[model samples]
Target: MIARLARQLGKEERDLQVLEAVLEHQPIGITRIARETDIDEHKARYSLRMLENDGLIEPTPDGAVATDDVEERVREINDGLDDLIDQMESLKDLDG
Candidate 1:
C-alpha cells in the first residue's frame, strides 16, 4: 500500500516540479520549460495538462502561469506532506 502511494505521489512530485518551473518562469513556453527543467517536452506537456485540470495553472499565448489558487494550495499540500513525514518518522520506533 505504501509502495503504491509512493508511486502515485512520485508522479505528482514530477508534476509539481513542472509547476515550479512554470511559476518561476512565468510566461514561458512548453519547449523552454522542458529545456529549463530538463524534462522531456512530452512529459512537460503532460504535467501542464494535469496542472490545468487541477486549476493550478493557466495557458497564456507565450506559455503558462500559476494561478492564484496554486500558491495557496501548494502551501497546504506542503504542510500536509510535512505532517506525513512526521507521522512516518513516528512509525520508526514501531518497526524497531
Candidate 2:
C-alpha cells in the first residue's frame, strides 16, 4: 500500500509539474511543457488531458491555458495533501 501511495504521489507530482508549466506559460503546447517539466511528451499529454477533464485547464487554438478556478483548485489540493501528510505521520508512529 505504501508503494502504491508513493506511485500515486509521483504521478500527482508529475501532473502538478505539467500544470505549473501551463500556468506559468499560458498558451503552452505539450512539447514545450514536456521540455520545461523534463517529462516525456506522452506523460505531458496525459497530464494535460487529465487537467482538462478536471476543469482546471482548457485547450485553445494556440495551445493550453489554465482555467480561472485553477488557483482555488490548487489551494484545495495543497490542503488535502497536508492532511494526507499528517495522516502518514501518524501511521509512522505505529513503528514505535
Candidate 3:
C-alpha cells in the first residue's frame, strides 16, 4: 500500500512539474515541457491530458496554457497533501 501511495505521489509530482513548466511558459508545447521539466515527452503529454481533463489547463493553436482555475486547484491539492502528511505523522506515532 505504501509503495502504491509512493508511486501515486511520484506521478503527481511529475504532473505538477509539467504544470509548472506550462505556467512558467504559457503557450508551451509538450516537447518544450519535456525539455524544461526533464520529463519524457510521452509522460508530459499524458500529464497535459490529465490537467486538461481536470480543467487546470487548456490547449490552444499555440500550445497548452494554464486555466484560470489553476490556482484554486493547486490550493486544494496542497491542502490535500497537508492532510496526507498529517495522517502519516499520526501513523508514525502509532509505533511510539
Candidate 4:
C-alpha cells in the first residue's frame, strides 16, 4: 500500500509536499499551506483540489484535514523511505 504511494509520490513530489504540509498541520487554510510548504498558492490550491478528488483530504469548517487513509498511507510511506529520499529529492523539481 505504502509502496504504491511512494511510487506515486516519486512521480508527484509537489503533490506529496502539499500532502506532507497538510499532514503536519490539520485544519490549515490554503494560504497557510502554501506558505508552510513553500509551494505557490495556485499550485497548492490545485493540489488540494486534486487531493480532495483522490480522497486523501476533505474540507473542514476552518480549513482541511487529511483523511484517515491518507494518514495511514503517509505513515507507511515514511517508514519505507530511509534510502529513497536522495533519489526522490533529485527529481523533485521535475513537473509530472
Candidate 5:
C-alpha cells in the first residue's frame, strides 16, 4: 500500500484552514482553531492529530507548536506541482 505522504494536500480544504489558523497562532489549541475556523473542536483536534502524526506539527507542554518548516513543506509541494504541470504541458504537444 502506498503511504499517502500527502494526505493533507488532497483532503486538505478543512485541514488547510486549520493549518493556516495554527501557523498564524502557533502553540494554540483546538478550541482556538475551532473558534477561528468555525470548525468544531473535534474536527480541529483531528486535523492537528493527523498533522502531528505526519511530523508536520507537534504539541508541547505549552500547546500545539506547528512544525518550524511547515512553510518549507508547503514550498516543496508547490514545487512538485509546478513540475507536474510542466510535464503535462509537454504531453499536450502530442494531442495537438
Candidate 6:
C-alpha cells in the first residue's frame, strides 16, 4: 500500500517540477525548462499543456507563466507531502 502511494506521489512530483519550472523561469522556453528541470522536452510540453488546460498556467507573448491558483495548488501539494513524509517517518518503527 505504501509502495503504491509512493508511486502515485512520484508522478505528482514530476508534474510539480514542471509547474515550478514554468512559474520561476517563464517567460521560459520548453528547451530551457527541460534543462532546468532535467526533464525531456516531450514531458515538459505535456505538463505545460496540462497546466494550461487546468487554468494553472498561461501561454503569453513571452512564455508560459503560472496563474495565481497554480501557486496555491503548489503550496497545498507541498504541505500535503510534508505531512506524508512525517507519517512515513513515524511509521518506520511500527510493524507492517
lDDT of 3 by residue, 1-96 (tens): 889988998988998998999999999999999999999999999999988988999999999999988899999989998999999899988953
lDDT of model 1 at position 3? 96
Alpha-carbon local distance difference test for all models? 0.88, 0.92, 0.93, 0.82, 0.79, 0.82
Q: Deviation in angstroms for 29 in model 1?
A: 1.7
Residue 58, model 3, lDDT: 98
RMSD, candidate 6, Å: 2.9
Q: What lDDT tens digits, residue by residue, belong to model 5 across residues 1-96?
A: 125735645456677787888788888888889899999899888888877886778898766877878888878867987997798689779853
Candidate 3's C-alpha runs over 4 A off are none
Q: TM-scores, in order shown?
A: 0.79, 0.92, 0.90, 0.63, 0.68, 0.67
Candidate 4 per-residue lDDT over residues 1-96, each given as its tens digit: 669977777546887888888888988888999899888899889889988887889999999899978867766767767557776787778887
Write one digit per residue (lDDT tens) for candidate 1, span 9-79.
Answer: 88888899899898899987889889988888998999999999989999988889889888798888799
Clashing pairs in 3: none
Candidate 5, position 66, lDDT: 77
Identify the runs in model 6 with alpha carbons over 4 angstroms from their true place: 1-7, 82-96
Residues 1-96, candidate 6: write the lDDT tens digits. 879988877766777788888877878878888999999899888888877887888888877888877767767767987998899899998986
Which of candidates 2 and 3 is the stronger one according to TM-score?
A: 2
Clashing pairs in 5: none
Count clashes in each candidate, considering only residues at least 3 apart in sequence or on different chains: 0, 0, 0, 0, 0, 0
Q: What is the lDDT of residue 57 in candidate 6?
A: 86
Ranking by TM-score: 2, 3, 1, 5, 6, 4
What TM-score would candidate 4 get against the native? 0.63
The all-Cα superposition gives candidate 2 an RMSD in Å to the true structure of 1.4
lDDT of 2 by residue, 1-96 (tens): 879988988888888999999999999999999889999999999999988998889999999999998999999989998999899899989964
What lDDT does model 4 reach?
0.82
Q: By the lDDT metric, which is better: model 1 or model 3?
A: 3
